[model samples]
Target: MSKVSASRAFRRRVSLCLLSSAASLGLSAPALAQEATALPDIDIDSTAGRDSAPATAERIDRSDLRARQTGSSDTAKLLQSVPGVSGYSAGGFSTLPAIRGLEAQRLGITVDGVTIASACPNDMNPPLSYTDPQTISSIGVITGVSPMSLGGDSIGGIIAVETAPPQFAQTGETLLTGEASAFYRSNGDGFGGALSLIVASDTLSLTYNGSYTQAENFEGGGPLGIVRSSEFAKTDHSLNLAAQTDIGLFELKGGYHFSPYEGFPNQYMDMTSNKSWFVNGHYAGAFDWGDLDVRGHYRKTDHEMNFLDDKGGTADGGMPMNTQVRQAGYDVKADILLGEAGTLRIGNEFQHQWLNDYWPPVAGSMMMGPNPYINVNGAKRDRLGTFIEWEKSWESGVTLIAGVRNDQVWMNTGDVAPYGTGMMQMADMMAAAAFNAADHRRHDSNWSGSALLRYDLSDMVTVELGYARKTRSPNIYERYTWGRGSMSSRMIGWFGDGNGYVGNLDLKPEKADTLSAALTLRDGGEEGWSFKVAPYHTRVTDYIDVVKLQDFTDMMGMPTGFVQLQFANQDAEIYGVDASGSVPLWSDERFGKGRLSAKASWLRGRNESDGAPLYHQMPLSGTVSLEHKLDGFETRIDLTWAADKNRVDPTRNEPRTAGYALLDAQIAYSWKNYRFTLAAENLFDKAYSAPLGGMSLGDYNATGVLRPVPGRGRSINAGFGVKF
Candidate 1:
């Protein structure tokens, strides 16, 4: 009787014969969620510090985000099953995400708790590219030491993402529900669709969502077939409203996004246009010295880049760039309720941003002629944060948490121009007159802290430990990009490694620290078997990394294209180990139930003052899976592998990648409210290359040899969903 105890007593007799056939069809559970049009589970609770203030997060729910949303519309690739996460490909919806080796403004992403930045400067609309992975529903991620109520800039940790709340109707019943989904993929023919709607009564509720996607250009099994500026298009829309009262709950949300083109096979421009808008608000209830939360947000973007049509459009006068942004934020938190063992959280946050990044003026150019190339004008950043946390618990099973935070930020800018002067804008007019003669305002303060502990040693083991420090600043293109020519520092940078940057106004404010640990083991209920690990280490301190300044040589002078960096502040470190597990093999009753899972990470980074190696650092990755279920059908297979990046980043000459493995499969089905899926991604088409996919520069001007950025061939996905 041990095939995991006879498959846990045959899944507890098939969940008691489906609850006695739903109580002989009387269906209670809100009348079986009104016979499957479901919709009735929206309890925001003001983010509960993103599910209990981090001590190793990693969530990703909504039924595992329904088979990976038809395989990818990027959304940071849904954090690739989180475990030291990874992703850095650009375009096809701006990939970026990275965790163990920290990436991009050093983590701390959010959406729905707001905090979105990256209005282009080559980031191409980050913040998970404005949602839309079928309109999100969960995503958590706290990869180690992040508390202080998840605020105070960032240092590689937090990532929230949530959407789908606003559900109501029961006490007087009047709820309507809806859902629809679609997908198609086949290399890069890609396609998409999504829709959702909900309406309720019993204290109001409303919801709506929409999505659209497109793709083209994808073909690669080697020899660089296709892949040119990867191609993309997007759209999303949202709305939400909620209210409950009697001392609590309220919500309001709004969203819109557009992308009329994406491209960007590793930087050198291509986004063509992006538009965004957002709104947010929230409130939670319960008092008597307990809960209470509040939030507010606003966002706007208007970005644009250039060169598309497979990277050579606008003839020779095209290299535009434009940016405009505005952001606003607010947050407030409280939890209190320290009687039965503790909980006392507190929060305050604010953000403000404004930017302008001009570039217009070509009309028969000369390195972009006649006037207007201001790079970053009217910038501004602003932050204000506050935190306090505490958690506790005991009764011989320990638990603790601690926090502290402070932020201040404030930055400034407003002045710049070039394009109209002589000698190809003479080094952008001496770097915009030494950035308008220095002192363009600046200020910071920053302080952060965190701590965690756990214990639990019995009931299937557990342990955890943590520490944090965190801090960050400098971004507005990292101390305002005043472009030192070389084609405006190769049009700024987002590190897709086509090199050329410039910006460092005394740049400081990185800080980090971290240190983590975790362990777990299980074998008891919920179908037995489990395992976990986690290990972390950070260091940072001023870390922004980059140096060089100019070098072009060639024709035997030996420097060969792509150099010119800047942003400085060294010292770094990173370390990692993540692991995951699951097992339960075989349970049959006509062939059903089986499982096996695994995950891996193993990262490393450096440059603690030139030890080199740290630019997209991700090597030794992993994934493995096997599954099979029954009754409602399911199948899985996966493999994914990496290892062989050859520790690159010799000051951004970074490109190495070799070593690969891939195979994926999926099959799904459900009945009752409908669901269907079919997948296959790289199932043996084996071409490789994409260790962070940097350095393609859209095929390096027709193969002038900079390489890296292949990966993606063999797609075939299909999806379906329904509910009404």
Candidate 2:
């Protein structure tokens, strides 16, 4: 019982359990008559009017994510201003989001609903890098229609991050709350801080949160200066516990994360050390055969990479790699209430993962003449899912939703014989005889479905129509990378996209079929004006490319003339459109209030058996803003644009960016719980680049070519917060 007497005996048993639950709900001890409410109401509502009214996901809260977390802590750059999202940067904050055109493992990120995997095989730890945006309190994006209980691998969509729940009090009061924040930035001199705490009664509640960040190398904007190894540092923490009786609500959560470094000058290795841990348990209730939920989770990670002035150097040759992952999952659902206009849901889920990658072996360099190799050993993957959903609402105003899901995935690996001796035992005996002649194990049985429809056509307008069928599977370096020459598949080049990959032992899994439509117009309670427009189309089937294998070998197999790839299977097509709106160009009552916003996106992908194009696709973008507010202060100014991609991809020669426009600004202030913010970001300091950003790795810069990687210059950020 040390550690400050176990935190003063756990705060005196949480102040005697909030004074015995406020004396069994009878009340007394007025602490401002306890009032602190908000949080906890999670039934995974990926916004957009959840059960339809025309919206379909797009939510970001926590005060606009704390004014974009004061200049980047990269949660995909705070979701690149939403609308079809876009981001890629690879440094100064692990960017990489992309939506309409998909991205990384095809998207399906979650937190507060688990699902994480990214021990860098070039992903450099995604999954929103384990929640941070100062512990996100909400974020939901669902790009190209997804809904079948929101989980079924992916087809480019679904991102949800939540935190900040558990806050009870009332019923004879007893509450204590907290919040604190700080931030700074000026082109990478960066800084950070965050915290939160809570304690309640009405049957217990507790919470804690934390954050920290750091930065350095980042000066770009105008001629691409600094930008060397981008620089980063991070930390996070979480804890929660809750309970409420009368047959319902219960929770338990835990989290921890750390990053000792996170540079990535466009990747080729850099992220020396990342650690993670998680835990979960939840239950929500109102039984008697209606509304019930149950959840479970577990996670573990330990990643590491090198080559940033190598800690012990060994730039991939002397060997230095590491990765470890373990995951577990569970979920259950119920929501029946089929009478007054329908509602139904049913669920089941399970997940498991395990991975290990190693390289270990240094002692005298010259490419480990001593042993230690494993590059992905004992890998495994498993999944099981089920879903059923229904929703109704009519009286002519119409609304209909439907769902269906089924999954059963499995993958395996083990029997990788590579233990060191000379040239790492002859390169692990030719990569264990090319992984014992391929096919270690595989299985799949997927099926997904979705349907949505809404209509209202009046009272302010609405309309929506949707369709979906998505599926994905094929990770672990895209089917267990087992090397077959040329730096042995360049370790699957993890999306830094400069190319180099290999893995395809009878691969197959990606299946898609989408169709969407939306149109909305508001005025009722959203005040002034609003608008939306959507359009989508998709068609895929076995799309997982890398192609270009016209001969290229190395690692004791001859021809190192370069140009080789693998990971085949194609046949794709994509289409897109996303639009946003806002109006109200003036307001009074002491002069303050103005608005005018806009957003846009347009995407296209192809290769429908060889029409080409498709590989980091994403072109034609937009953003426009001009805002103002009064009393509590607020301001905004924006502009963002992109275009000029010139449809590339010719077997991965990709490249072709050009087109730019930036300019940003922000200002904010609040009085009551104290708040402040200021931002600037790329205001005229433009040197531009980023067509899916990804290139420019070691050497040549300062305009000496080796392009891509530019953007980020002209910074200025500030933040502050307080609450109690």
Candidate 3:
């Protein structure tokens, strides 16, 4: 069994033990049984006891979503339900969210506006998995259209995650709040928990959020039937402190995230641990000159990776690898009103990054004559940008948003010894190696622009239209990785001609055009009805994709022995529609309120270059949820259906996972002083696999050899939180 798989198996037993403890504490009671008493909605900015929208443009509170769905292993995965979004490689544990058919370098993820270094060279960190769900205050996504304050790092869309702030009451009394919860699954035996602390006084506040997760190897998809994986463990914690005064708000936050020895689906290497430290400072206030906000962030990441051959089972056969990245950023923005006709926002952003590594053959020898080798090709990159956005409002509750941004990126690729002293290159003792360690440096500048119009036709009906043009620069991996992506013992599994993979120094930026629309209805809790639907279409040009060259050689003609991947332009199209809403079932203040909410979504994409379905096209799916709350107690049930996916073309045999429905149940009790909850997912113990994947052909040869991908099975999770 792979180290990861063995570790997962052990965790399953632990999860079952925790679930037993929760059931005894009444954490599994149905919410429907507690309706004797309930609190009415409290107004944040309204004079009435009931809270109402402060303004048509103001953001609503989202703290209630925390711990809303524990035990549903896919709870975290649901974060990608935003318009124009898709998910790839649905491992039972960690999965990456793809936006507008663009991933990897085409996207950027940040915490409080600071970038987290991607630990795996093949992009396993993904842009979304960086933040813990429970710590999130609210997530805002701007598709096709972007706000200047983002610093121009986005291509298709921008997803911003804000940490929840401590809440303060009017009585001038301080409140201390905290909660803890855990759950287990029957199939994979997954267990996890989250703890939070919030302290708030009139003007001073502090908040902390932390979570740890562990799981056994999941049951195999039909084919792998339990492809045992590496032993996995992870822990993350975040702290935020803010102070408010009559003049403005001042705050600072710091966080630490770590994952020890996480396994990869199809790669040969395993990541020992990934650690990231982040700090952010901000100030925001409204003055006689409208409103102004400014912020700065600094982040440092320590990444370590290793490829162990296990010799299929033995230990000493593996190699060690280490890489570190340092990144820092600063941003500023101001919002000004123009005679109440509209608002203008202007901002500037600057960022820098540096990467250092010793791998392929750590503590290595060169392929030629026992020479020692050190890589100089991997080094530093810096990016800078300035932007502006304007918004106009009209009498009919109509708003127009438009923005433009420009950015420049500079890369410095230092030196690289022809053939690193790795196992593959050292085939011959008398081979000539290239010593031209050149500083291949280059800079790319791009412009992005977008516009959106929104109109509220009635109290319950709203419509929006949007369009945008954006460009993205090639990522470091696409521009610098030389020879095969020999990650921890596993070659990015990408073998072109297969001597070594070489990067193309001259790669172009990718461009995209998008058009989208949305319609929403707010059926005020009257009948417990609400809904939203969105549809979007995108056209891509100068699209950058991986082009592979098979077993090719270098200057010595001595079996260069590697595959080469170059970033080239390709054409593509992506379009999709998604709808979500809620409806109430049994409503009464006496028995407790009950409701059912459902979400349905679909997406379709294709390579304009060949009319084939684009990779990662999530099929039609829907989620049905029923919940009841009584006397500070809550109970709920959720059913999710995933459609069958038969359309696939790749290196590995992509199975068409059949349409399957998963069911779950949860119960929680809340008192003025605290709350506790427990949940059970995949209650049926349905044995099934969530099959998904994508692949590219390396024309470097004729017989297009397909590679393998990862598939996962049924899993469960549990989490809890509190307020006092």
Q: Which candidate ranks first by lDDT, i.e. highest?
A: 1
TM-score for all predictions? 0.33, 0.32, 0.80
Ranking by lDDT: 1, 2, 3
TM-score attained by model 2: 0.32
Model 2 Cα shift for residue 163 (angstroms): 33
Q: List the global CA lDDT of all models.
A: 0.79, 0.74, 0.56
Report the C-alpha lDDT of model 3 over 56-158, residue by residue, as the tens digit. Answer: 1212124445445354333226554444455555233345656656653555555555555554454555545566554465555444444444546556665
Model 1 TM-score, all chains together: 0.33
Per-residue CA lDDT of model 2 for 1-724, tens digit only, reads 4332343344334434433432332222233234876644646434342646236578788878886787777877788788888866675556768788877578887777677876667777788876678668888887757668777877777777878778888878888876667677888777766667788888889888877676767776797776666776767888889888888888988878877667676655677678988889988887665778788998898887766542223334434578888888888878788788687888888988898887676676544435566767868888899989888888788888788888999988876545453453564467677777776899889888888788887778888888888888888778887654445455467565555676776889889888888787889455588888898988888888767865555568785334557887788988988999898888897889888989988989998887888877878888898988999999899998898889978676667888888888989888766677888888889987778766666433223346666667898888776665
What is candidate 1's lDDT per residue for 1-724, written digit by digit as tens? 4222343344334434433432333222223344223333332332333323344676776677867888888878778677888888888877888888888578888877777888878787888887877768877777888667767788887778887777777777878775666777899877776767777887888898877777777987755587788877777888888788788878888888877678888888887778888888888787888877788888888988888756676566577888999988888888788798688888787899998989899887766877778888878898999888888878788778788889999899888888877987888898888889888888989988888887877889888888888888879897888778777887788878777888898899999888898887888666878888988889888898888987855568887757988989998988888998888898888998898988999988988887888888889888898989999999999898988889888777887889888989999897776678899888878888888888777877666666778888788898776555
RMSD, each candidate, Å?
24.6, 25.8, 7.1
Q: What is the lDDT of residue 608 in candidate 2?
A: 88
